[model samples]
Target: MYQADIAIVGAGMVGLALARSLKEADLSVILIDTTPIAKPLSEQPELRVSAFNAANKQVLEQLGVWQHLDQQRLSAYTQMQVWDQDSFGRIQFSSEEMGTSELGHIIENQSLVNALHHQVSQQPNVQMLPSTRIAKVLAGQSETMLMLDSDEVVSCRLLVGADGANSAIRKYANFPLTFKDYGHTAIVATIKTAAPHGKVARQVFTPTGPLALLPLSDPNLCSIVWSQNSQQADELLALSNSDFAKALQVAIEGDVGEIGVESARMHFPLTMRYARQWLSDGLVIIGDAAHTIHPLAGQGANLGLQDAFALADSLQKLAAEQAAFHQARQLRAFERARKSEAVKMIAAMESFKQLFGGSHPLKKLIRGVGMCTADAIPVIKQRFITQAMGW
Candidate 1:
């Protein structure tokens, strides 16, 4: 039999961050995952990337993992340009306006995970069980037991489901989940543009959906996330590389000049998931396991990381006060704090989707005027910039 103070299912960035944050706390942690904990990054940039805002960077720094990340693979974007195709409304945000050197860093997801894994490995209070699957979860009044595929039983005072969107832990616990399908697909690929990205992230709202070109480490290379209706996405995916490049050029109005696809294209359906209840007795859920939002704002990973920090803080307080680890009040407190933020972000993304995806003339006029007006007002733009930075 194996045991710990807390058992976290999933060794992704959020799970690992949680473990690392509690390294100094007087609690034992066992992290279980079905896959290997770490892998070498490819020489070429990865297709799965995330925009890490200032707040997320601070969390990484606090967890002692940010310093180990490969600087060559990180791209710092100092400016953002958002515009609408149907209207003359446009807004540009710069770090200079916010008195910061850079707004955020564009990092490959795998790189961040690798860094967190390395840091967790060095922690004395954490145990990582790789290639281990939980066959069953048995929740008790004060503890939860996980039956692994190897027939080993592990028990803990608290159980956390940090797994991805399709969370087995949440399912086994019978937590209520609400899902919203956006009826769109997000196509992602890396591209080489005729003009350099100049460390700027550009996004355009088309009738179909939003297309974002985020600057990568390479000056002439950018990662594109094109979200469109299922039918349009299928058509885009069916086009030849050259044809797709041409279509992309027209989509962004050639903002980065002529473009050519430099990597394999991948697409996934867009969905938002939320758990009605995030905590039950000795159990809790975080990251995509609890909620997931659209990719339009590139805030999914950022939100997940914040969940890690919030959960860790709650757990540490419980440990410090020498309170019962599995107390429902403490767990519910964490859930309440994080769930409210998740709800706000999810709603904001939905509003943006509807505002930009609508074909109504009034919405188009409002969007155009809103963008221009927001840009004109320093206080309004500052508020937006601060919010985007995860303030």
Candidate 2:
């Protein structure tokens, strides 16, 4: 059997980031995934993208992976506008207020993954096994043996589950998960606008749900996440491209002008998942394997990146102190800290969703007053800026 200090399952963004972060720990790492990672780079923007805050960007920088990302594909927005539909509640902010160049960047998921996979591949201490998955996980006191489909067996001192929402590692380890069905289906697609986005990220809260128009590198292009209840989503998805564009034009109230579908529409149900236990005997989970939050605030990926960063830092310190990888106390502490952050984010999303979910007059009035108040007050605005920028 092949022997290593650590084995990480799932070579997606989060998994690759974790492997890259551990490059300097002088520990042998084997990264495994069923899918081939870091596929050929694409010049065209992808349908799935993520907004990265400063803190997460810093994490990538520290891992020496940020410099590898393509500059042309990165879209930086200096402004943001959020408002309630058909109400006097509208709020807008700019980078100038915070004395920053940008609030954040929107990058295609594949773009970032390619960059990270490139960096991780260079680390001599890391071995990446793509197109191979763990067929069986044999547990033991000192180590665990991973049986692969190719009949290759590997032993590791610690096992990490970074595999996404339906993580096989998480399931095999018997980690309990607490989840909530948001009853929202999100339609995502690439869109072209008649009006230039002007480097602004905009979101509108409608009676049915929320719609976010995320600016892309091209001034006239954007990636949209239009979330609505199941019934509404079904109707919207059934409409023809032309009809849907008309419907989108009305829903957006012409904020970005005419809407043209530039890519195929794809969607998935929204759900919040939190693993009741992130640490198991001889195993631990991170990223989506640990928890998943609502995308309304765009904190899901940022949160997962943070988890990998923190765990890496913890592992480095532990190694410096000559501590065992499976020491109960140290592992537990790491788990607690990351879990707390996830809980806070989950609570914030639920509260925000409920607060703007309905058309109740009283709630609308409260939202209008609150948003306007936050916009008008520098202190309150600063608080929001701090959160959005991940300061």
TM-score per candidate, chains pooled = 0.98, 0.98
**What C-alpha lDDT do the candidate models reach, one value each?**
0.92, 0.90
Model 2: per-residue Cα lDDT over 139-239, one tens digit each: 99889999998999989988989999999988997888899999999999989999999999999999989999999999999999998998999999999
> Weakest 10 consecutive residues, lDDT, candidate 2?
322-331
Spell out the clash pairs found in candidate 2. Answer: none
**What TM-score should be assigned to candidate 2?**
0.98
Clashing pairs in 1: none
| lDDT by residue for model 1 (263-358), tens | 999999999999999988798899999998999999999999899988998899999999886777767878888999999999999999988996
Q: Which sections of candidate 2 miss by over 4 Å? A: none
Candidate 1 segments whose C-alpha is farther than 4 A from its true place? none
Report the lDDT of model 2 for residue 113: 91
